[model samples]
Target: LSEIYPRNLMRKTAKMGGLPSPSEFVKLVNSSASQGDIQIDHVEVIAPIYEKWPPDSHTRIFLDSSNKTDEPVYAREVLSNFLSRAWRHHATDAEIDQKLALFAKIRPKCDDFQEAMVEVLATVLSSPKFLYLVPPGRAKRSGKSGDGNRLAAWELATRLSVFLWCSTPDDELLELSARGRLNDRDVLVSQVKRMLADPRSRRFSRHFVRQWLGMQLLDFLQVDRKAFRQFNPSLKEAMQEEPIAFFDEVLKHNHSVLDFIHADYTMTNERLARHYGLKDVYGNDFRRVELDSTHRRGGLLTQAGLLAMNSDGK
Candidate 1:
């Protein structure tokens, strides 16, 4: 599920700490954990080792057979085979063919075929078709299995992933779609509940309050520095986080929405509690503190987030 980055690839190379043969490159790219093993599925040309072959080195060019003086006829063949294996299920023959043709078109202009294939690989990575999960074919009145109109398995998986995890489908979800088993309501509900239970669902609170109070525009508010010297960067960060934490607690604990107005408890870390004149609270952990009538800190209005956002001066 993780995107492969050049830095991580380089780190793996360093960990190996030796001149890498083509087999080593194959091992790195085709490793199960990296993008999953491709060897069992098909033969693949591992992307060129950048350090072993400079971007346009003569040796690299010679490998692709574009040098005409000395070239490997199997270079393009190997690259095409590798790409097809790596992207086996996701890309169609037409798509792979298009990419191979791109390699052919660029090979004459470039010094080496490996370099040309690098350009092709870069294009494949950046292509919208590769990066985005697009459902096959145009929208139709009826879907597979004679449903008059319903979301396809892939589309449903995408919606469920974004709603629950706020991200794209992982291998499990994608595999479910590939097997055509993501349509059950019970299964979808289970996934939704699981995702909501995850810590990342705190995003819900952040998005809700930001829109509810229209505080988004306040980013441009110019504070009078001399008037509000107490408002430091740490205080501002604490203010934003306090309400978000509180709202998350409410959701996690299934507390009534009315608690937002009537509950005496507020969340605060040491720094925030000190700013709010709450005594004896220490450390950077948020804990709920019950408010007394004398404190007048019953709800979010008394919280640092809203207070800071609403404060004009003094």
Candidate 2:
């Protein structure tokens, strides 16, 4: 059993047909009567959930601080740290003070400091500073600029991160923006290059490719096993990943966009390679393989997932 974060897909696989599962789940003493994958007759045994004592999740939230017990003392420290991160490192003293006051007011009504602090933390999370990217109005350019919707250094960093990484700016980007020189053309280019080079940019590839190609239809389309006997659930996943992986490769190498329509290679694993009548490629991991005219596979149109999704299964 793989300890993967995405819901342990191996556990729910149907053993009868080597195809995608479409069965509905029901909880009973003998729900899966004849199934080999799930034994409903036998007591369902789960793998050991926790590998470490006190667990990482608990230690992460309930941090190892000196004032773990003293809510009055630790509330300021915790709130400040949490607000800074939640606000994408743009947390201000005023915001911190407001949260601390809320915590103090709620402390007496709640059973303990943790419970009271939680209420304050919720408010901080819900605040406009945390939710909205209210750009800092820094239109004071040296040359000549009036009302140039120019995002402040920190604000630009936030948008850049969210645009590329789908998350908050890292410490490096935030520090660069705070220096106020991030607006400089050369500096901005360097920062953009840095962000595009980071592993987090994979989020952009995934998000962009999915939206660009209308991949959501794949989720609802049922594969016809009678026609596509080789098609399995894992192959279905690989299909969705192909376009994203291809896009990521192009972005990483700064390849021409024309490659999208006519590439020299395609992303594939053993599952996909086999489906495409490719030889020698093996393993579940996806990688680009050189393509030739004889292969009859070139670009996104030839991708198994797209072909399958568009087909009537005849």
Candidate 3:
């Protein structure tokens, strides 16, 4: 929708039937279409878009320092700060010293500080500190263990974030864990709620549903394309998206898990509705459409994508 028609609807209307052609636009200009010019002397680009100067990104690299000119000191400070976030553990002074030693060795060989640090950062990324999230012995989320060992708060927070968001813990989650509140049932519940509300949680639905349902099998199996008249590459993509979309809808609405097998409404879009002989829905956007018994469709089994994947390719 953002592609076809943006929210602002700038110089566009449903009746105009898409952007005016170059010649049509020129004709409108001559015919005196509403003429207005608002001169913009400057613009303030926002964060998560354009970083503020001395940009947060710049500050992230070049932190405040008592000995700013002491490159080695500042480099040590930066590396320690980065290790805490990337490794999800505090960097011991010894560890930082070792890394700074490498940085010092590399810095003199490079054109500049930034270029030299890239090699150090690459080394950190390849290290186990970045490569793996090793759950300690008996530090699982359930906390029920014969040995009675429990996960640290940060450990639990990292586990939750990775499982749900398939990413590192955000600031709030890490803070909660640092405070040793993550394991508390009430705090855990609140954090779970917050994580669910986060957009990142969508990753959980995509990955979990795809794997659990074996949706990737769709890619390997050749559909009987000729027999299925409407099953082209674009439609094939839509078919693959259907189950994931359905799963996402069920998750977002907190609908019953049984909806995978039986739901009154199935998600469809212009392409899917046409393929399903579903009426009225128009546009690329997928949406829920109410289905009755006559449609002979409600669940995963009846989907064209799955059915084709299951077919003996003709």
Model 3 lDDT on a 0 to 1 scale? 0.73
Candidate 1 per-residue lDDT, tens place, 1-314, comes to 23332232453332213444443433333212112334245445556646665454444323454434433345445444444323323343566667767777777877665556666777756766445555535433333473322336667766666655555565677677667666777777676676678776676667776777766544545567798776655566667777777877887788889878867788887667877788878766678887767776656776666765676645
Better of 2 and 3 by TM-score: 3
Tens digit of lDDT per residue, candidate 2, span 1-314?
21212233455333222333333232333212122254235445454557976677556545679987777667778877778667865455777788888878777777666667766877877887778876565323344353232236667888888999998777777677767767789988888898889988989989998898988878777877898676766678778888888888888888888887788899888777877788888777778899887775667777777786776655
> Considering summed lDDT, which 10 consecutive residues are worst modelled in model 1?
26-35
TM-score of each: 0.57, 0.71, 0.74
C-alpha lDDT of residue 311 in model 3? 68
Model 2 ranges off by over 4 Å: 1-70, 105-119, 135-151
lDDT of each: 0.60, 0.72, 0.73
| TM-score of candidate 2 relative to the true fold | 0.71
Off by over 4 Å in 3: 1-68, 138-151
Tens-digit lDDT track of model 3 for 191-225: 88888888899899889877887887778767676
How are the candidates ranked when ordered by TM-score, highest leading? 3, 2, 1
